[model samples]
Target: EKVAVVKEEVRSAAYKANVVKAERDALRLSLSVQETTQKKQVEQLQTLIEVAKAGNQDYSISNEESIKQTLNVSEQLNEQAHAEMQEMRAKIARLEANASSEIQNLEQKVKVVEAVLVGEVPAKRMRRRVKTKMKAAGV
Candidate 1:
């Protein structure tokens, strides 16, 4: 009778341990699935960022006024897209201004380089020509 009781006690303990282990395994699997889902969401957000950057390309703008209007619509939508649109507009505006400034600087540098190549024309003469062109263009 003592031996039988001991065996039954051992079996009961083993069964309880197995049940507890199974629950732990299930919890681990649930946690893993949740992690995977969260990772996918993060990747999707990254893709949206890339798409927003693409929209900032200057060549893509057919008409600035029309685009500005559409931007106004997007701003009204309060969609996730609105944030991206606003960000792209601000970045593109800054980039365009910088690019225009750089282009002007490069043009001036090129004229200086040309003067250097063609032998000495006084700096004053080149400056006069550039100034005249700018005045003519109202810039």
Candidate 2:
């Protein structure tokens, strides 16, 4: 019974670990997509700036300022995203470590329970039986 309960606890911990891993993977994929989109936007803005520079001076200057502002905002957003990703990575690492520790502890408990069960009659029972037999034998 104790072994069964321990096995169930182990299974629960494994399931929780898998769920956390899946969530982390999904977050990573989202961050990657956001980065790719940001890069494309920056490339497009650069191309526009080049075209503007080759055309009108006044128009180019205004567009340049606007582009600079946009670039700054994009850079800020990217930095924020990076920070969030780092924080999430750290959180996942901690969670993984905790789950690993819990699983190890549970496995150890299961081993101890199995060892005790394998001994058939428990040590105390065997000792008591020995005493009873010794008394009967007038020893």
Candidate 3:
């Protein structure tokens, strides 16, 4: 019964790990899409800046500032995504370790139980005491 419970717990942990992995993959895909979009925007901004320079048009200082701000925001977002991925990876590692430890403990318990059941564990002391009690009772 206890072994079954342990098995169930192991299964639960494995399922949770897979769920986390899927979430991580989704987050990665989101970040990748965001990165591509940001890159396109940056390239378009750079082209506009170059065209303004070539045409001798006075580029608005506000435009430059806006580009800088956008780049900064993108960097921040990338950093945040990277940190979140790291955290998820760490969580998965911890869960795997816990599951492994639980399995080892369960295996050890099963081994002991099997040994006891198979009479590999010594029962001589108990047998001796029981025999003494039976002799005293004149059985």
List RMSD in Å for every model shown. 35.5, 8.8, 9.2
TM-score computed on alpha carbons, candidate 3: 0.58
lDDT of 3 by residue, 1-139 (tens): 6446545655766676567667667766876786687677767767766776677567787877877787677677767767876786687677667666655555555544444446654678855654464445333
Model 3: CA > 4 A from native: 1-56, 123-139
- 44-83 in candidate 1: lDDT tens per residue? 6555555655776753444544555655554444444445
Tens digit of per-residue lDDT, candidate 2, span 91-121:
9899888888877777766665655567644
Residue 63 accuracy (lDDT) in model 3? 75
Return the TM-score for each candidate structure.
0.39, 0.81, 0.58
User: Cα deviation in Å at residue 52, candidate 3?
Assistant: 5.3
In Å, residue 1's CA in model 2 sits off its true spot by 0.6
Task: Please list the residue runs of candidate 1 whose C-alpha ends up more than 4 Å from where it truly belongs after superposition.
Answer: 56-139
What Cα-based lDDT does every candidate model obtain? 0.53, 0.78, 0.64
Instruction: State the RMSD for candidate 1.
Output: 35.5
Q: Residue 5 lDDT in model 3?
A: 55
The candidate scoring highest on lDDT is: 2
> Judged by TM-score relative to the true structure, which candidate is superior, 1 or 2?
2
Best-first order by TM-score: 2, 3, 1
